[model samples]
Target chain A: MSETVLYDYWRSSASYRVRIALNLIGESYRSVPVDLLARAHRAPEHLGRNPQGLVPVLDIDGERFTQSLAIIEYLAETRPESGLLPGVAVGRQRVRALSHAIAMDIHPVCNLGVVAHVTAVAENGEAARRAWMQKFIGEGLAAFERMLDHPATGAFCHGEAPTMADICLVPQVYNARRWEVDLSACPRIVAIEARCAAIDAFARAHPDRSK
Target chain B: MSETVLYDYWRSSASYRVRIALNLIGESYRSVPVDLLARAHRAPEHLGRNPQGLVPVLDIDGERFTQSLAIIEYLAETRPESGLLPGVAVGRQRVRALSHAIAMDIHPVCNLGVVAHVTAVAENGEAARRAWMQKFIGEGLAAFERMLDHPATGAFCHGEAPTMADICLVPQVYNARRWEVDLSACPRIVAIEARCAAIDAFARAHPDRSK
Candidate 1:
């Protein structure tokens, strides 16, 4: 098998999301940690590979790619049997929509860089940043629960097996817990996270284990 | 052909993206105006169709979907000849990453709701919001310019033909121009947008025309 390499940071929900995907694909790769706090992502080498300055850029068969969802979609396409995305158009739409709720709506709004900017502008302190994260995280997940109410949602965000939606959901849930966002209203999301937790792919990809 | 309906807010970059895609596909859809100012997106009907409370919910042949990129991907898959995304895996990844640079990084951060939240906390008024948008938009476009510098970039975002990346790029450029963000640094993106502007597909999807 050809070697795959992942540029990662331990706690980034985006990076964590990609790790889960790699694990699910059963692809073993060397993980080169990008120390985000150390401002390593801003370095020239990293910028050359990914102008977005985001972590979880993957190199598979010498082809480099960035964006967690994009990388995962690439995997799903090249390695179709991974089931990263469901097969049918409607099913794929549902999974992608669910993934965006957290990835685009929730995660990006409260990204560490964004939050830092918010703090600098507002100067409202850590409590304010936490509150900001909590509010959006709560609302985003509540909406996610509504999306999951569909009959298609099973043990995962899509069906019986984990898809890209589940891969994204677990990490956002991880962020929610880290920021102490209350998940009382998102029973469906919590249940899916529980199911994902039992899977070795998800279990071994935990941020704690990534360390 | 199935009748397709797009629930849209004219000025929204996301809605604009779908409009361009629909135009590119040569598919006509009824556009239902969802007044973001009136908070119509929070209405029960809209929420039921799109739990995320965002615009550009597409209904075609009774199948409903959300997220502009996902909907575009579906259209690209179902309408293979439209060339919304490229045929090759590497090509698709490049297009998606470019789309996400604006969709996930710049757009979400400056969304109306997010900006409103910024005003509420920062209390710095419109100037602050515009500055905030400028900071991210400028940096994002600068990054996008670097992404465009690749050999893949052509008359549009990818090759000579317009793909999903151009569909996304046009609207982001629209937003950037509207927000008065300087495009001087992003020569490549500006050139692409100018080329896209001349195309009837993009012109018809203009927010002004949507009105």
Candidate 2:
């Protein structure tokens, strides 16, 4: 095994998803914290590594990989013994869709960058920012809750074990809670989050646990 | 072969992505147009198919699949003859990451719902909405341009043949251009889009070509 280094920010929900996936897969990786608040991602050094300037860039054996869901799927495929994804094609698609619903639909709407963009233009300042965050997060999460009603959902987001969907879900839930968006309407989501939190892998991968 | 019915809106970039994939695979499917302007997606029938109330739901043998990328990947896997993804693990991950770089990172930020939210709050009207759209679309397309600089980018988003990445990129670029975001900064993306557009499969699947 080669040295694995993850460029990440503690509070980035995308970074957090990758962290959970790595932890679940039992891969040992060093963390290089990127300060999102300081906009370190846009710096030249980070840009050279990832032109998109996004965190959770996984460096494995000197090769760099970006995109949290893609990194997690890479780990699942490369380290098949960890079994982060199902073997069957349809099953994999289902899991991927569930993961993407959270990654694409939910997380992107309330990201810090988007919120900041809204605040930059809105007349109401912080209140406007908060409102913008709440509206998107609320709608996205409610849609996710409806998705959870699928028969595939079990203790985790899919089936009984932790899969990529769970990896994506827990972090988004954490971020939503941080923003004070109520999750009471999403019982299935709240339940799954609790199940994920109980796992040692998820417990160790929480944002506050990292340096 | 089982009947596959696709519920899609003609103008939806996400739906356009799925159409490209379907054409690439040469799959015969019925198209059920959902009117976004009339909120047809939010109707009881469509809501049951996809609780997210989104378009591009691919119903195969009574089971409906939501999310454009997921449906595309599922089709690719089930109909392996088309081989939309690479055979090797690393190459597959690269393609997926590239697809996600656009699908997750770019599309959601400038989505119709988010833009509507911005306009509703703006009170300053169409100018504010356009500004909000331009800001996100510009940043995202520029970032996407950076991602395209990698050697992996060929005539398409991945290798010579159009894959999921190209499926995602063409529609996004089309949307960005519709919003009048300058594409001069992304010559690579423009080149890729031109290649994709030249293909009969992509041309037939384009938004303007759809019923």
Best by lDDT: 1
The worst-scoring run of ten residues by lDDT in candidate 2 chain A lies at A116-125
- Model 1 TM-score, 2 decimals: 0.98
| Model 1 ranges with Cα > 4 A deviation | none
> Which clashing pairs does model 1 show?
none
lDDT at position A166, candidate 1: 93
Tell me the tens digit of each residue's lDDT in model 2 across B15-120.
Answer: 9999888888887789999999999999998899899999889988556799888888788778877878888777888888888888888898888888887777
Please report the candidate that would top DockQ against the real structure. 1
Candidate 1 lDDT by residue in tens digits, B21-124: 99999998999999999999999988877878899899886798899988998899999999999989999999999888888888899899988988778857
Scored against the true structure, residue A179 in model 1 reaches a CA lDDT of 86
Error of 1 at A135 (Å): 0.9
Q: Candidate 1 docking: what grade?
A: medium
In candidate 2, what are the lDDT values of residues A1-211, reduced to their tens digit?
7799999999988888888888888888999999988989989999988988999899985678999988887888888877688888777888888888889987887888888878877788699888877788888889988888878888877788989988888888887887799888999989888988999999999988985
